[model samples]
Target: MMRGVMNRKVPKEILDLFEKYMDNKVRHLNRKDAIHMLRAEFGLDEEQASTMFDTFDKDKNGQMSIWEFQQFYVCMGTQPSNPHSSAQEVVQKFKDIDADGSGKIDVNEAKEGLKTLKTATGRDLDPKEIEFFIETTADDDGQIDLGAFTNLLYRLKLYNAPPPPKDVKLKNPKKD
Candidate 1:
């Protein structure tokens, strides 16, 4: 037997979605998929979808896992879903907004990050919502450090749910 960490079981719904996504040959979800998924499922526009995706995919990996998807969805005022799109674009946008190349977004940088999202969407998200999202997703040290951000993005991109949402969430609130 291969002595490797047992691959975490993926929820069936997520596995189905992954199969569908793979049938489309999308090794990783891209900007278009992200936008389409959001619009079809959440009624968000291209800009809003893009901004949300960029926010979640902090590592720019062009994919997202369930955990990362949940955080991003919550941040965007939406319920998390099975097979949510990738967070790669979000990470790249974060880096671009950092400007100083410091790999961490301070309060001011965080505000600027929101501005970038607003510009992308042509409207400002609620300030409280923005703060809530940042505070919840930021590192324990209260910084949007690069590694933490990237890990979040990677989680979202690589997520593979093997069962239904109800069962999955009920069985494991904090999936490892």
Candidate 2:
């Protein structure tokens, strides 16, 4: 088994590998670059690399900045191993939801995606709650970007976050 990379400082070689695949223009790694690095350097299969991308996509933007990558490395070092659309599947679903190919899931597409996915919450999600969930994931213009939607799907399948209580009102929930 591969050791938890974060158990100690991330090795220099791994750090070098990150740079080896990183996009110099943006100084970050997109989904493809990250997956390539994970596979080439760590011998992760496609599913594993995709899952790690979800874990590492702190902002849910489908991209990993240097700080996000390092922070993920540090956190990974500290966590216990636990037991996904597999990871690429979640990503593909996100792409499918991006019907217009704008690389983002607009409100209309999000509604459609809600249909494709089974309700993660044990109880059937009410339309209002579904509306709220999409609302929360949306940007100011009311669109769910690929990162936001992918992370949501990942969380739904993996973490199973509970829907908020009906009586509760979030005055200002944090985004990203």
User: Highest lDDT among the candidates is held by which one?
Assistant: 2
Sequence-dependent TM-score of model 1: 0.35
Clash pairs, candidate 2, are 6-77, 60-147
TM-score of each: 0.35, 0.50
Candidate 1 lDDT, tens digit per residue, 53-105?
67666677866544455454544332235223333344466678677877677
Across 33-134, the per-residue lDDT of candidate 2 in tens digits comes to 887865665445776567667767778998876666665444333222210223344557777888888867888888877766755555555555567678
Alpha carbon lDDT at 125, candidate 1: 40
Worst 10 residues of 2 by lDDT: 77-86
Q: What's the true lDDT of residue 88 in model 1?
A: 39
Q: Measured by C-alpha RMSD in angstroms, how accurate is candidate 1?
A: 14.0
